[model samples]
Target: MDLQQLRYVVAVAETRNFTRAAERCLVVQSSLSHRIANLERELGVKLFARSSRRVELTSAGEAFLVGARECLTAADRAVADAAAATGVVRGTLAVGVIVTTAAVDVPEVLQRYRARHPDVRVLLRAGGSDELAAAVRRGDLDIAFLGLPEGARPPGVETLALDRDEHVLVVPTGHRLAGAARVTLLDIADETFVDFVAGTPARAQSDQAFAAAGLARDVAYEAGVAELITRLVARDLGVALLPSAFVRPLAAGDPELALVPVADGPRRVEYLAWGRFNPSPATRAMLDVLGVRGADPED
Candidate 1:
């Protein structure tokens, strides 16, 4: 019925527990319970089915949640728009990134953005490129940095290609293939590899290349982080094909690791993606900080 009641309902739904929701909302448990009870009585429908162990959203609640979130988003955006008119930006900016991205220095960019707009709250999340792109499309993220295979763009959003570079083969210093001038996929076809998880965009870069070469590799280990993959390679557990930008600095730091050029390697493209529709002022400011003023949200 009111914004307060809606907030309480959303909080409870997200936390799935009354006590935690109350704590998150910075309200006492009894007060939050009373407000939700009043709202249910007014609507003549139970929004939640409450049990001692957990609180579950009922069918009616599920339907209400969709509109409730939209209403809250609109309200917040209205306030932010009003503030923007007075030369101030105030809103939450949710950014998603992949762990292996090396095109843009994320922390430094965030620090600069924070310095310019201290009023805007920033939330950062780490995920696979595909997952982060989906979050941006779903309005869960305001912007995202993704590292996808060459020529593959994330669908349903506006994107800007940041960087494109080929992959390199990483090996342990003592390995036979280390210090090689250059190696092709055929050279490493029989060697065990440590690579990103199968089906991920990061993994696809190498997978597509090997498939095109008519070669199959044995991936001995699957790790999400590039650093972990490099660690496994350093121990001589396996060799890996990684983005040149990410592997270069890593090999420089670790004496046990060596970088070998891949003559026929897959290329990875880094992208900056955001929603195509009306962007919040905070999103615009972030784009400006990234040197993309009036960035076209179109492909």
Candidate 2:
């Protein structure tokens, strides 16, 4: 019935627990519970099926949440638009990125955005390209930086290809192929590999390349973070194929590793992705800071 009550319902639905939802909304647990109960009574529908161990949304809650989120988005946009008309940008800018993004310096960009619009709140999240792209489409993230295999782009969102880099082989300094100027898939087919977790976009980059060559690789170690993969390679666990730009800095670390170009390695394209229409003022400001627009090429 009210925006505050709607917010309480949404928070509870997202967190799936009264206590955590209250913590997120900066309220006491009992108050949050009472508000949601009052709203449920007003609507004459049970929104959540509550249990001591967990909270699950009823069928009604799932339907209600979609509208609730839209209402909040509209309300927030109205306020932000009003501020923008007066030449001030005020809103939350949620950005998502992959761990291996190398197109732009994220920290530096955030610093500049903060300095330019101190009134705006900035949020950053890290995830796989597919997940981040989905977040952008869902309006959960205002913008995202993604890395996908060559010629691939995130669907249902506006995207700009920022940079393209080939994957390079990462090996211990004393490894056999470390001295090689370049290698191909056939050359490394028998070598043990360290790679991203299976089914992830990062992992798929290499998987697609090898599959095209009709070769199979032995991925002995899997990690979510590129830094961890480099550490594993440094310890002689296995060599890895990773984006050259992402691997360069990791290879320069304490237990240094070597990078050899993979002649037939996968190429990854870094992209800036955002919702296709009516981005918030803060989101627009960020795009301006990045020197790009949704209408740019590859949109």
Candidate 3:
């Protein structure tokens, strides 16, 4: 009923646990639970299904959370507007990034952005392009770095192309093609493949390339993170196609992993994407500090 109770509901919905949500909200577990219980009693609907193992949102919780998030977003915007009137920028800048940005200069940009606006807190989230872009579209994230095909980006999002990197073939050092000067999709078509889970930008681009070359690939295993894919390759489980900047840097640490040029493989463009009318003051400041180039996305 109250704003604080709504905040508690939103936090618990996001974290899926009372203790962790209470910690994030800077309150004790019992107090947060008491507030939520009071709200549930007043509403006369169960928000969450409590279990010893995990918490799941009930039907009412799912419906309540959507409105709760919008209310909080509106309140946040009002507070930000008032702060801006006094030339004060203080808020959280929620950012998302794909795994490959480990090679990019994101840290430098964030450090510099914080130097200019010390009161703004930066929170980073990591996921594949599809997940991160979805979060940006839903206003869960203010901005994100993602690998995407050049053709289409998500709706309600503006994009700034940062850099494009080619995909490379990853093989264990002992694989015969590891020493080859050039490799093609045809050469690896029949080999067992290790790939990212479906819907990731890397997987999409790789699939496109294989299809364009008129070949079918056998994906033997799928992993969520780059490290797992490389480890599978190193163990000779299967070969994989990955971003050059993402898997290439592992050469120094993993001597068994060999990164080879994919010889005209697909190139994935990295982008900084945000809501078209994103109004976060800290987000605007971060954009200025990064000086990332942008143009209106084609519909």
lDDT (Cα, tens digit) per residue for candidate 2, span 105-218: 999999999999999998889999999999999989999999999978889999888899999999999899988989999999999999999999999999999999999989
lDDT-wise, the better of 2 and 3 is 2
Candidate ranking (TM-score, best to worst): 1, 2, 3
lDDT of each: 0.93, 0.92, 0.84
lDDT head-to-head 1 vs 3, winner:
1
Residue 272 of model 2, lDDT score? 94
Candidate 1 weakest ten by summed lDDT: 290-299
Q: For model 1, which pairs clash?
A: none
Top-scoring candidate (TM-score) = 1
CA lDDT of 266 in candidate 3? 74
Candidates 2 and 3: which is better by TM-score?
2
Against the true structure, candidate 3 reaches a TM-score of 0.85
How many collisions per candidate? 0, 0, 0
The best candidate in terms of lDDT: 1
Per-residue CA lDDT of model 3 for 18-51, tens digit only, reads: 9999999999999999999999999999999999
TM per model?
0.96, 0.92, 0.85
